[model samples]
Target: MTKSTQGFCFHTATSSHVEPLPNAKKAMAILRAAGMKKINFAGGEPFMNAEFLGQLVMYCKETLNLESVSVVTNGSKVTKRWLAKYGEYPDIMAISCDSFDETTNVKIGRGTGNHLKTVVELSQKCKEHGIMLKINTVVNRYNFHEDMNAAIEEIQPFRWKCFQVLIVPEENGSEHTLRDARRFLISDDEWRLFNEKHRHQECFVPEGNDVMASSYLLLDEYLRFLNKGWESRQKVF
Candidate 1:
């Protein structure tokens, strides 16, 4: 119901691009001047270049006067200092976490150890800093059966966004993906069962394959809108 972004750029998995993207300030200014409402700072890990990320977040909220600013992060780089420095900027901080089991998480390539623990710590920091915490989980073959209600209850995120392991032919299924989609793909029945199990949670926000395919104003690493979903990307400049 609130005003939100039409496009954003972020990696669905751990990012390989260590260097920050080009013309970030100019991009923010352009989007703002174009009447864009919210600017979400995301990507191969926005915090990889924390200084630049902080600048964009501040600029969107302060200079651009955008309605909301948000970020999609892996939670490892979100720190107390980061939240303290730019806490007021982002209206939401979404952390990607897929599984609760250590072994399953490793298989899912989310991380090697205690991914949930780190997410929980970040949640606390967000709470302390007066920021809204959102938990994002991608349902895949590896984690579809694992019940996440306990972990969700523990983190107490303002929102829990559940997504199907999105298979984009030109993206996750392409050569650029961080992990193999073959190993992660799950059946519709499996996804349905998983949803039926946790859909009752107050924070639950479901995004299925049809909904995913319908439309999203997602910007690629180059700031181009991935207009045709995952199959192709388009340049706005």
Candidate 2:
């Protein structure tokens, strides 16, 4: 399941206090019973409530015996200590790094000055802890022109997934959301060009809007299944 948990610090108003651990554990059991083997935690910054996220990760691996468990993060809030404790449980740690350039990353609203540095440090820690690293890049207006080959090679992630910046009405394109991402939208040709430039990398995996739209089973913070619509996610589990 992609976006297995939806509370993110920067995107949604997901309160850690409101999510019941017992209910979440029950949800995991349901997924396991349904034959779901791999689960990825995304939607909001998983580290916002490190304890909660760690518990879920450990449960998926140790108790549920899921084939693979992963989490995607912006790499700022991750700490070495956290990895030391729970890293063994996660099969992969995918860090979002849109651009290697710090300025470009800041412009893209990824984080402050040290975004790249944080990703590098986190990648190293994941390596030490035996968690395979993956790099996720969103190709947008601010970063489509930049070359990320060197930085990605340096990090040496097992996979380098690049995506065309997608604009969903209520998600990132509307005023009601935390981020208005229309300005970041790029043309199909631009997206293709970005992929073409980096196609030489054996690890490169690019996904455009259409492929990204229908690819995954997305769940919100409330554990409601999110269905893709022209504008927003309109359905429930």
lDDT of each: 0.73, 0.78
Candidate 2, clashing residue pairs? Answer: 8-44
For model 2, how does the per-residue alpha-carbon lDDT over 1-237 read when each residue is reduced to its tens digit? 212121112234334333577878888888889888999997557887788889999999999999999999877778878887898899999988888888877777667778877888888788789999999888888889888888777878999999888876555667777666777889999998898889999999999989987887766667766534544543332
RMSD per candidate (Å) reads: 5.5, 3.8
Q: For model 1, how many clashes?
A: 1
What is the Cα-based TM-score of model 2? 0.88
lDDT of 1 by residue, 1-237 (tens): 011111111234332433243466676677667778976766656777787778878888888888878888878878778777888888888887878787877766666687778888888878877889988888888789989998888878889988887766544565565433655778999999999999989999989888977645666556667545445566556
Model 1 scores a TM of: 0.84
Structural similarity to truth (TM-score) of each candidate: 0.84, 0.88
The residue pairs found clashing in candidate 1 are 7-217
The CA lDDT at 21 in model 1 is 36
Error at 37, model 2, angstroms: 1.7
Question: Which stretches in model 2 have alpha-carbon errors above 4 Å?
Answer: 1-18, 176-178, 230-237
Which candidate leads in lDDT?
A: 2
